[model samples]
Target: MAAAIERLLSEISESEDPLEELRSLRTAVSETPLSGLRESFSAPQLRVIFSLLNTNDKEQVEVCVDVLERVLQVLDPTHLVQNCKSELQSGLNHPDDSVKVLALSQIGRVVSHAEGTIEVLNNPEILQDVIQSIGAERISVSKEAIATLLKLSNTKAGLDGLFHSDLLKDLKDVMAISDVIRYRVYELVVELSLVSPVCLEYCANSRFISQLLEELTGDDVLIRATAIEMVTNLAQSQHGRQYLAQQGIMDKISNMIIAADSDSFSSFYLPGLVKFFGNLAIMDSPQQVCESYPAFLNTVFNMALNPDPSLTPVALDTLGLLGGTVEGKQVLHKTGDQFKSVLKRMSQLARDGATDLRVRSLEAITQLLVLPVEQQTDDLLLLTESWFASLSSQPMEMIKHISTQPFPELHCCALRIYTAIACQEWAQRLMMSTPGFTEWVVDRSVGKGKEAKDCKFELVGALLSSPSTREIFGAQNYLKLKTYLQEGPYYVSAVSSVTTEGAD
Candidate 1:
C-alpha cells in the first residue's frame, strides 16, 4: 500500500498530463482501506498532493483536493490537525481562488465530525481564515467560506465555538462589504437558526435576528425585498412561524402590503411581499389569513386586474395556489362577487392575453375548478360549475378553441382545464351537447406533443372514470373512450396493406 501510494505520488509529479495521474491517485486513495491509509499516509505524500493545488489547471486541482479529502477522512483528529491543517490553512491564502475554494471545502469536510470540529475550534487562526474568506472578491470563494462556517455550526460544540467568541464579529465585518455578501451571511444565519431552538436562541442573542428584522422593514426597497424573502423562508417551520408572530413580523409585513398602494416603488418588492402572504395563507388557514388580512386577497385581485405584465402573472399564480385545496377554493368562493370579477378577468386573459399570460390564466382556472373525488361535495361541485360558467358564455368552446391553437403550451393548458371539469356531470353534459367535442377528445390527431397527448388522455380518462359517465355518455361512446384510455397516451395505430405479386 505504501509503495503504491509512493508510485502514484511520483507519477503525478512527473507526468506531463497530471489530470489523469491525479484521477488515478484519487481512485487509488478512495479504494484503499482507511486502516491501511492511516498507517501508510505520511506528510511528504500529503504535500505531493497539496503541490497540485499550485497549478492553474482547475480540474487537476479539484482531483488533487478529492485525493487529499479521502486521505484526511482516514486520519485521526490529532494527526489531521498536526499534519494537514496547516496545508489547508495555507491554501486559504493562496493566490488562486480555486485553491481557496478547495481549502474551504476540505475544512468544511473536516469540521463535519465532532472530533474535527473540536480540532478546528482549538485553532483560532484556521477559524479566522474561514470567516475572512467570506469577503473574498470571488463570489464562489465567499460562498464556499460561508458554507464551511455553516458546517461548523452543525454540531453543538461547533455552534458554541462560532457564537461564543469574537469570530462572529469577524463575520459581521465581512458582511459589510456588500449587500450581496450580507445576504449570503444572513442566509447562513437563518439556516443555522432552523437547526434547533437552542441554535435560534443563540442567533437571537447575537442580535442577528434583530438585524434581520431591521432589514426586513428598512427603507431600501431592494434590501427589504431580500430580507423579506429570507424571513419568509424562516417562517416555513412552525417554530419559525411562532418566532416571527411573537416578534410581530407577520403583522408588519401585512401592513407593508396594505401601504404598498401609496408607495411609488412598491412594485419592486410587492411580488415577494404578496408571495410571502400567499405562502403564509397556504401554510396556515386560508380562511384565517384572507379574513385577517383582507389586503392580501384584495391586492391579489387588484394585481390580477393591473395591466403590468410583471404583476399579473404573480397574482394569477397566487390565486391558483390559494384555490388548489378545498379550503382554499371555499375561501375564494366566499369572496363572492369580488372573486367572480377576478375570474372574469382571468377568463379574458385565457382567451385574448399574451401566450404566457393565457397559459397562466388557464392553469389558475384549472386549479380553481379541480376537486378530488373524495373531497367533492354538491356545494363544491356547483361552485366549480358556476366558476366555469363565469369564464365565458361558452366556456367549453372557448377552451376547445384554444386547444386548436398552434401554441403547444396553450393547447396543453386548455386540455388541462377540460380535464379539471371532465368528471363533473354538467361538464360531461356540456361536452355531449357541444358538436364533435367528444370525438375531438378521443382523436389523437387533434393534439401534438407528449404533454398534449397526456392531457387529452387524462381528459378522456376523467370522462370514462366518472360514476355518471355510463348514464350520460352512452355505452358505445364509453367503450370507445375506454379503448382510447387502454392504449395509453402515446399509442400509434398500426397500418397494413397487402401487395399481390405483379398485380398492377
Candidate 2:
C-alpha cells in the first residue's frame, strides 16, 4: 500500500494538472491503510504535499488539506505547519466560504498537534489576517475566524497577542451582534476557564455574564440552562459571586430555581440550574442566603423521594455538596428521622429489581451515615441493616458487582454503623456469627479502605462514647482496639517510647 501511494504520488507530481491526479490520490489515500500513508511519505514528501494547498483551484486546496488531515495521524506538526503556513493563509482567503471554513477547522487540528508551539500563533501577519476575517461579512469567514482565534487561544503567545490586539473586544462585539457567534464565544470562555480561572474573571467583568444571565431570564429553557452553566463557572471564585450579588444575579438564579421548580424540572437545563443554586447556596453561606434551610432541605428531600431514580442521584449529590458546611450538617442531623425513612424506602426499592435505585441508595447512605453522631441513632442502624440484608440476599455475582463500585464513603458509613452496633454487646456478638463477619470488622478497623481510615477517630469516639464498648473492648480487645485508635499526641508518645531502645 505504501508503494502504491508512493507510486501514485509520483504520478500525480509529474502530471500537468495534478488536481485530477490529486483527486485520484484522495481515493487511493483513503483506501491505503494509515500506516502505509505514514511509511510512504517522508517529512520532505509530506511538506511538498502541504505546499500544494496554496493553489488557486479550490478543489486542489481541499484535497491537499484532506490528505494532510489523514497524514497528520503520523506526521509531526512542527514540520507539517512550517511548510503549510503560507498555503493555509492563502486557503483562509479563498473565495469559496466552504474552503475557508474547512481551512480554519484544519488549522485547529494542526495547531492542536503542535500544542505548545508559540511561533505558530505569534506571527503578527497571521494574527491580523485572522482578526480581519473575524469582521468579514461572510458568516463562514466569521465562523472560521472564531475557530482560528479559539485555536490561537491555546498558546500563551496567542493569548498575549489576543490581549494586545482588539480580538477580545471584537469577539465580544460579534457575540453581542450574532447568536451563532455567541455560543462559540461562551464555549471558548468555558474551555479557557479550565486553563485559567482568571479567564472567568474576564468574562464576569466583561458584559458576558450580564448577557448570559439575561438569557437565563428568557423563555428559551435551553438558553436559560446554558446561561446557568456559564454563570456557574464564573461564580467559582468569591469575587465572581460578589460581582453576581452586587448585580442582583443571585436573586435571579434563586428565582429561576424556584420558577423552574414550579414545574417538573425535567428539562435539560434543570440539572444545571439545580447544581448552580446548590453551589450558590453552599458557597454563599446557609444562614445569609435569603432561602431558609428547611425549605431547601424539604425541596432536596422531595427530589430524593421522587419516583424518577435519576433525580435521586443528583439530590443525593446535592446533599453531599451541602454536607460540608456546619449548618447543612446540623440540618441533616435535625431531620435524622426523615432521612432514616427515606433510607428504609430506598433499601426496599433496592430489593425490587431497581439496580440504579440501589446504586443511588448507596450514595444517599454515604452522605447520611457519614453525618455527625448527633445524626446517627438506632433507627439509622436498622435502616442500614435492612439494606445490608437485602444486599446479602443477592447472588454471589451480584455481591461482586456491589463490591467493585467506588463508594469509599459508603464503606465509611458501614464502619460507623458497625461501630454503633458493636457498642451493643448482644448485637456485636450476633454480627460476629454472620458470614465473613470477622474479616469485615478487621477491614473496617485498619484495612485498605478510605472510609476505614476515616472511621478511626469515630471508632475511638464510639468506643469511648459508649460505656459498654469501652468496658468490653477494654477488657478483651483493649490492646488491639488501642492499636487501631493510636492517633494524636498521647498515642504518638506511647508508640514512640515502645520503639525507643531502653526507654520503656
Candidate 3:
C-alpha cells in the first residue's frame, strides 16, 4: 500500500502531464485500507497534490477534488487544514472551478462542526473566492460554494462579514443562470435578507424577483417555496409589501395559492401561501388585499369551523393575517358577518381540548382585538361577553395543562389568554364583575396554585382599584377586596407588585 501511494505521489509530482497520475493517485487512495489512507496524506503530500489545482488542465483538478472528497471522508481533516492551510486557500483562488469546489466542500465540513476554524474560513480574499464560485460554470461547484457560505454564516462574525461583502451583487447574476444552482443560493439569500435591511432592499427591485414568483407555478415544490419565500422576505417591509402589490405580485401569488388545495393544508404550496400572505397583509392597501386574495376570508373561517381538527388552527391563523394590517381589517369587515361566525369558531378553538389547537385559536383572537373599530363587529361587547362565557371554565383547564407538558408551553398559553383578557379594560371589568369570576381570580392568584403557576393576579388587583367596582360588589364588598389583597400575603408577591403598578 505504501509503495502504491509512493509511486502515485511520485508520478503526480514528476509528470509534465499529470492527468493520468492524478487518476492513479485517486485509485491508490481508494484501494488502500481506511487506516492506510488516513496515514498517507500530509503537508508535503498536499502541496504536491494541490499543485495540480493551479494547472491549466481542468480534468486534473476535477479528479483531484473528487479523490480528496472521498479520502477526507475516511480521515480527520485536521491534518489537511492545520498543515496545508495555504495550499487550500490557493485552491479556492485557482482558476479551475473544480479545485475551488473541492476545497470549499472540504472547508464546509471543517468549519461547521469544528472549533478554531473561524479565522481560516472567514478570510476576506478567500471568502470572495467562495462568493465568486457562485457564478461557476458547473452547477456542482456553485452548489458546493453556496453550502460553504451557509456553513460559514453559522457564526455571527462570518454572517457580519458576508453582510458587508460587496460580492453579493453577483448573486443576481447567479440567480439568472440555473434552477439547480438557485436552490442553493436561495438559502443564503433568505438568511441575508432576514438579517440585513440592505439585502432586503436588493431583493425588492431585482429582475430575478419576477422569475422567482413565476417559478412558484412550476412543478417543483422546493423551488416554489424558495421563490415565494423571497417574495415573503420582501413583503416584511412596508415599502416592499406595497411594491409587491403594485408590481402585480399578488396576481401571480394569488393564482398559485388558488392552485393549492386550501382544504388539505399539507399541499405543497400551503406553507408558502400562508407565510406569503402573512407578510403581504402587514402594510398592504385595501384594494390590494381584496383583489389579490378574494374570498380567502370566507375560506379560512370555513376551514377553521370544519370538524376535522387538523385544518382548524392553520385556517384560523390565515384568517387572522387577513385582518393583520389596517387595510386588512377593512378587507376582513367587508366579508360580512360570515366573518362574525369566524369569531365564534375561534372561541371554539380556544376552548378545544387539544392544547395546540387551543393555543393557535387564542392567538387568532388576540390578533382580532387589535383591528380598527370601524372594521370590526358592531357588537364587540357581545363577542367579549361570549369570550367570557367560554372562558369561565378555563381556570381548571389551566391547572390541567401543568402536568401535561414537561415544558409548560400549554400552561403558559392558557395563562397568556387569561392575561390578554386581564390587560384589556372592558374585558377585565366584565370578568371581574361577573358572579364568581373575581373570586376565582383571587383563588388562582393566592389560593392553591403556585403564584408563578397561576395567571389572574392582575385582574383581581385591577377590580379592587377600579372606581366602578361598586357595581360588581357594593362599596362594602369593594373595601373587603382591597383588604383581602393587602393582608393576604399576596401583596408583596411578584404578581402583586406588577398588578399594583398596572392599576396605578
Clashing residue pairs in all predictions, respectively, total: 0, 0, 0
Reference-based TM-score of each model: 0.90, 0.56, 0.54
Q: Summarize candidate 3's per-residue lDDT along 1-504 as a digit string, tens digits.
A: 768888788777788887887887788777877777776765587677766676666677678787777677665565566766787678777777667777888777766754535555445666766777776777777778878877766665555555544545556556566775675566556554554455554544454455555676666676776677677876676655556667788777666656565434335456566667655555555456556577444446666767867557668777666545545555665666676676666765565547778767766655555422333344554444454454335533433343244435555554555454443446556565556655555543433344433434443454555444666566666666676566553454354434555675
Candidate 3 positional error at 359, Å = 1.8
lDDT, candidate 2, 120-169, per-residue tens: 65555555556556655686677677677677666655665565456566
Q: Which 10-residue window of candidate 3 scores lowest in summed lDDT?
A: 395-404
**Candidates by lDDT, descending order:** 1, 3, 2
For model 2, the stretches where C-alpha displacement exceeds 4 angstroms are: 1-12, 15-47, 51-83, 90-151, 154-181, 193-198, 237-242, 261-269, 280-295, 308-310, 320-330, 370-430, 433-504
Among all windows of 10 consecutive residues in model 2, the one with the lowest summed lDDT is 488-497
Candidate 1 CA-lDDT value: 0.86
Candidate 1: 10-residue stretch with minimal lDDT: 73-82
lDDT of 3 at 314: 65
